[model samples]
Target chain A: MFATLACVAAMYLTPLVWMISTSLKPEAQATDGSLRLLPVPASSVVERARANYYGEEAAGGAWKPGVWTDPSVDFPRFMRNTLVVCALSVTGMVISSAVVAYGFSRVRWRGRGLVFGVMLATMMIPFAVLMGPLYVIFGRLGLIGTLAPLWLPAWFGGAFNIFLLRQFYMQVPRELDEAARMDGCGHWGTFWRVIVPMSRPALAVVALYHFMFVWNDFLAPMVFLTHRDDFTLALGLQMYQSKAGNTPWNLLMAASTLVVAPVLLLFVLAQRQLVSGLSAGSVKE
Target chain B: MTREGRENLAGWVWVSPWVIGFGVFMLLPMAMSLYYSFTEYPMLEGPVWVGAENYARMLGDGTFWKTLWNTAWYGAVVIPLATALSLVIAGMLTSKVRAGGLFQAAVFIPTLVPLVASAMIWMWLFNGRHGLVNRALGLVGVDGPVWLERAGWAACALVIIALWGVGQQVMIYCAALREVPESLYEAADLDGMGPVRRFVSVTLPMISPVILFNVITLTIGTLQVFALPLALFQNSKGGPGQVGYFYTMYMFDKAFADGEMGYASALAWVQLVLVLGLTWLMFKVSGRVVHTRG
Candidate 1:
């Protein structure tokens, strides 16, 4: 059992390890078919890293003047665009979903159950069905070629996030709400002072999930954003891959590592929350 | 006004965002999509009504049929393999292994890599002459096929790529496995059931509902797989002989690249029906097999 598990682990880890290893080598070494995991002589690692990241210009090559003139991808700009989308979408999703969830779980009102049922049904409708008309809608609204199409819809509650938060909110003791009400608190005050404070873990889960979603999303950016300057990291990586005919495998791997690094770091830090969130989303009571 | 009326008003105010969002983003778009599916609406021009013309054209369109077959084939192969592989791995991890968390992390980490990045990594690994996969196979004195260059091999390459991200399903399976009661195992032991029999008779039934749930989610996900193959082939059209060209990719191309909005809307509707039908079929077939606890 131990040996089998070890083999499975090695199988899974090899691609990631190879991604990093290939990024450290020079172009020739990367495609040489040699099994060596590092650059030959290993002293040129820093030089190779600089060339791969900042382009040949960093290694005593001719400097280009304009952004379009430079052959190297503007990775930092793409990272900035991706971060902007993530920040806007994650914040909006968390706050809006929490507000909507409070209505579903905390308040007793007519037709609430029916409305919640409709929201759950909406989750089953795949995005493919919406992407067509959404393109036209965004074009008409002049949101194409801008980042608004990517993050604006998030201000409205996502069905899944709202459901997850509602599930969490339902577990909050009703007595706390009563206590707050006795102190002359309305629904807004109770939600702010009592529910939101207590449900931080669940809110964090929603925020993290949405952050990763926006970060990894490729198709939406591909369909909505037209300008190369507006591209997210995922879209930029694709553009980088296809732009060069004989793209240096080493540099490509380096770019891939940059795109994957932060998500891996986040995974290491929040594995528990992510794992529980995954189970919570699928495994029902 | 009565207190109930005031509470109702408050509820409407609180949930208004989602209500408005659903109306504009979902219901309105769906109605428009259905309307546009029946017309000849190019992006640059207004819709001209063409009753069922787009759907009829799909019947004779060779690429449409090819892409549909490719997508269905890919989903049929990927879904079961991913589910079973993850379930087995999850089973192994749950059986009191030391360093289980470490092993689980190794499995789960790949799912964190974005689709485009993973596609790039796999492209290098599956390169015909110099890739690590071919190099490893060469160690055993076997010649490796050019993965992304041929028809059958390209489809096989995509299947392999799909299997790499089974880590998420594995994590979910691990959680489900841990939830199975210990007393069932004891009962199986008392009945002198062997390990394999114990797993089949006891563990499988206990976690069958989770298996069903995972399969449904996997079906929905795998059917809409777009980014990985798009990034892998690096073309709006798919790889060699269009084997990697999928339903969503075709829809995307028709809508955006070709500006065949009406045709693409028709394709989208067909995909929606296929997904709904397959999901319903799974539920129907699994009605007897999936064990729900009382």
Candidate 2:
């Protein structure tokens, strides 16, 4: 049983470890020659690449034993773009979801169920179908080639987050609301003092989940942000992979490693909360 | 016209953003898209009422039918496998395993890898000559095909990437599994039933609603698939031989790339009807779904 568990752990973590290992190895060692667990001695790196790549050439005369040029890739810029996008989108999502959730959770009104149903139904609609229409709309608004399309939707109330928070808010006892109201606390005051303060687990889950989704979302940004300079980390990694003049695998790996670690760390930190939320607060119980 | 009315107005005020956005972004667009499906506009020019030519074109496009077949084939293969994988894994993690939380977390990690970065990772794994897959195959004394370069193998790669995101669904299953009643398990044990029989008699019936939910949702998701192929194919609109052109790709290319908005809108309406039909079928079949409220 222990061995099986160990295998499971290894299977899950191996790619990540491989990513980090490939990142640290000198460019020549990981990509060109026999991909090794340990980096080849730095001195033998160029020789190995030459013998492996050039010696296998159709004509030896046509081969050039290109010297190893450890390319310094622009990892920092890609990492920055990722951070900015996640920050903007996640912050927007948290605020928007919380406000919308408050309306659903605490406040009472007519047509509430109808409004909630619309949100739920939209959730069922696969986002892929909306892309072309959104593109045309954004283009007409002159919002093409910008980050606004990626994050602006969050400010209008994302259904997934609204549902998540609304579900969690229902779990909070109504007596708190009654108590706050008895103290002459208005709706805003009651929400700030009672509901928001108490729903930390749900809020944390919301923010973390939002961060993960937006941080890893490449397709939306890829479609919307067209400029080379505007690429986010997800798209930036691909750019590095296909860079002109002999793409550097090591540096691309390096950038990917840098980009993925923070999110991975965040996931590990919040795993319990996230998984608990999945079972407990997710799916609108 | 007292407390209820005041609270009602406040509630509307709070939710007005969502209501307005939903109307503009989803409801209005959906209705407009329905209208435009009958026109012959390409966004560059004003739409002219053409009634059903684009729909007829879609039927005859050859590519459209092929894409639908591919999307359906993919949906057919993935939904069952993914749903089953999630259920069995969730059962394992929840019932038999002690490291339930850790295992759950590990499994969900792949869903976090951005689609593009994961695509890069997969390309390396599937690299024609020196890929890790081919290298692994060499160790087993069997030669590997070029997974991405070949049309069939590219489809296989698409399926694998889609399956990798099954992590999220697994977590959802894990959530659902916790809600199952222990009394049923106790009843199974007391009846001297074996594990398999116990699962059939008890576990399967209990979680069937969640299973149905996952299937219906995932099928919808798989049918509308686009991003994976777009990432994998990169610059080539579809994939090798347009094999990666799921119906969504055809629609996207028609609207944006080919500047044929009216045609694409037609395709979208067709899809909307198809989806609604399928959803209705699922709902009709959902009578058998066992909802465990506990």
Candidate 3:
């Protein structure tokens, strides 16, 4: 059992480990005939630093080492672009989904159930169906080349996120809404004072998931953001691979590692919440 | 306003963003796409209605058939394999291992890596000459095929990549595995069932509904796969010999690259029907196997 578990772990972790290992290798060592996981030891400490850590131009201007100094891959700029998009989309998704879910869960009305049911059915409509029409719409609006189309739809509330939030909102006590209402609170007041305060965990779950989704989103960005300056990290990573081709394996891996690090960091920090949030949202619902 | 009137108005007010959004983004686009499907719209000019021509053209489009086959082959293989792998991993974790949490985390971390980034990593790993995968294979004395360059190996490569992201499915199974009643296992044991027998008779049935749910959802997801292949292939040209070319990739190429908006819209509708049909089929076929709680 232990051996089996170790093998599984090795399988899962190898690509990631190789990514980091390849990122540290010099260009020759990266694409060389050798298959060492680490850089060979240099004769001197300065040479080792130059070969493995610091960027250096080897003899005859053949190779440049290190990811950051490679200059072709702009990690920080893409990171900024990704962060901005994620911030807008995640905030919009949480607030809008929570509001929409409030309507579906907390409010009572004649058409509420019917509308919410239709909304749930919308979850089944794949994004593939939306791709062509949305492109046309965005093109018509002159937002095709901008990041607006990529993040703006998030403000409308997606069916899946709304469903997740509504399920959680339903579990909140009805007495809270009534008590807030009895205190001369209107629907907005009751929602802000009662529901929002009580649903922090659910809200966090929605926010985290949305954050990851927007951060990891490749297709929308691929379709909408045409210019290199506006490329999100995921898209930028692809652009890097294509522009560089198979030559710069080390830098390619480095770029991939940089793009993957934040999400991995978030997972490491909040694996429990992430796991429970996703499982509860899907399986329990 | 009357009490009911006030409640109804407030409800609409609260959901107005989604309602407005649903109309503009979902309903309007769907209508436009349906309209576009029957017409010729190339983005350079207005749509000209041609009435089923786009759909008919799809029949003879060889690339369309190839992409459909590729997508179906991917779904057929990846869905079941991923499901079983997730379930087995979940089973292993639940079997009282030390540091099970760490092991689970190790497995789950890859799922968090964006599909685009995973493609990059795997592209490097699947490299013919210097990739770690081939290196590892060499250590085991088995020669690794040039994965991305060959049609058969490319499909296998994508499946392997897809399997890596089964962490989400694994978590769902783990949660479901925990919900399986211990008494069922005890009863099976009392009836002379060993570990294998107990797992087969008790655990599998108990978790069957979750399995069904995961399978359906996975089916929906895998059928629409795009980003990974988009990242993996050179020039985003789909995999070697178009073996990794999926349905969405084709739709994307038609709409954006080929500028055949009408045909692309028609393809989108076909994909929608196919996905809905397959999901429905799963519900029907798996109905007999899925055990619901009383």
Candidate 4:
């Protein structure tokens, strides 16, 4: 059992540790092939980029074909772009999803089930179908170049998140809504004061799901985001993938490692909740 | 009447955002796609009505047929393997193993790696020469085929990569597995039923609802998978001489690369309708199997 646990732990931890190690390695030593898992005199960060050896002939100037290594680290900017898109998308998803879920869960309108069914049905619609139209709409809206393409959809009661929250809301007793109404609490007031307060675990699940999803999403930003400044980490890394020359894979891995860590940590924290929520069909409603 | 009106209004207000979103994001696009399916709509030019040309063109186009076949094959093969593997793994992990929680986490973590990242990992892992797969094969005195470059093997490659994230499905099965009552297991044990018989009679029926959900969802999800195949063949032009190319990839290429916006839009709509229809069919067919508790 201990051995099995160790193996599993090792499997999960290895790639992560490789990412961290590669990120910290001075580019020269990183690429030098002599330095395997451990860093070669790897204590410092800045000096690692421009070493005297390993074909770097100049100090951050034009490089010759065989040997010029322009060692520059854009890790910080990479971090920023990733954070902005992920933050916006996750936030938008949570608020809008909760609102829609609130409507589906508690409200009693005609065509409610039909509308809900339609929304649920859309979940199966492969994004392939939406790709053409979404691009065209965003282009028309002139929202293509910005992060609006990323989060605006969420502003429209994202069905997945809404569904998730609805399932959770259904699990909660109708008595809560009744009691809140008895206290003269309006729907918004009830949602904010009573339901939302009680739904912290599920909300965390939603937030974490969105955070991980948007953070990891490769296709959306690849299509919509045009500017280098607008690059989310995933898209930015895709750009990095297409980067010419030796393709500093270790550094790319580093950026990817960094990009996935916070999200992974969040997942690790909420993994159990996510599993239970999924099984319980909390969002399936 | 007044109370009913108020409740209806409230419901509408609550679900209003979804309606708005669905209209703008989904409905509008669908309408335009239907309109454009008849027209020659490229991103560069305004769409012009061309009648059934696009659909007709799809019929004659070998690549389209190939893409459809590849996607169909993927759905047929991978769905079963992924489902069966996940069910088995979920059962194994959740069924009173020592350190089950750790195994559960181990299984699920791969899905969280993001499809893009997983593809990148597999590129190296599936590389012909220095890849871990080939290395492992060499150690065992066998030569490994280049996974992504070979046609017959490339579809297999994507399927294998897709298998990595079977963890999510596994997680689902695990959750559903817990829902199976212990009494059934106890009764089976009392009757001296073996693991195979016990699982067949008890576990399968108990988790049938989830099974239905997983199959339908998995089909839709797998049908639309773009990143793995896209990423796997990033430098190679397309998937294993387009042998591994699936429907989404075909639509993506048409829309983004080929600039056949109307055609792509039509294709997209077709894919959506197909998925919806299949899901509805599965729901209908599985009615006999699924136990809906009142």
Model number with the top TM-score:
1
The DockQ of each candidate is: 0.77, 0.41, 0.74, 0.48
Q: Rank the candidates by DockQ, best first.
A: 1, 3, 4, 2
Name the DockQ score for candidate 1: 0.77
Global CA lDDT of candidate 3, please? 0.85
lDDT (CA) per prediction: 0.89, 0.74, 0.85, 0.74
lDDT per residue, candidate 3, B1-294, as tens digits? 999999899899999999999999999999999999999998798999999999999899999999899888999999889988998999998888988888898899898889888988998889899887888799889999999999889988999999998888888888888888788778887899988888888988888888888888888887789898988886546767888888998998899898989999999999989888988898898888888887
Tell me the TM-score of model 4: 0.89
True contacts kept of 4: 0.54
Which scores better on lDDT, 1 or 4?
1
| Candidate 3 vs 4: which has more TM-score | 3
Instruction: Tell how far residue B168 is off in model 1, in angstroms.
Output: 1.1
Off by over 4 Å in 1: A55-72
Q: Which parts of model 2 are misplaced by more than 4 Å? A: A1-5, A31-35, A42-75, A243-248, A281-284, B96-98, B292-294
Residue B93, model 2, lDDT: 75
Q: For residues B153-202, could you state the per-residue lDDT of candidate 4 as single tens digits?
A: 77777777777677778878887887777888999999999999998888
Better of 1 and 3 by DockQ: 1
Task: Give candidate 2's error at residue A31 in angstroms.
Answer: 4.1
The 10 consecutive residues of candidate 2 chain A with the worst lDDT sum are: A64-73
Which residue pairs clash in candidate 2? none
| Count of residue pairs whose backbone atoms collide, per candidate | 0, 0, 0, 1
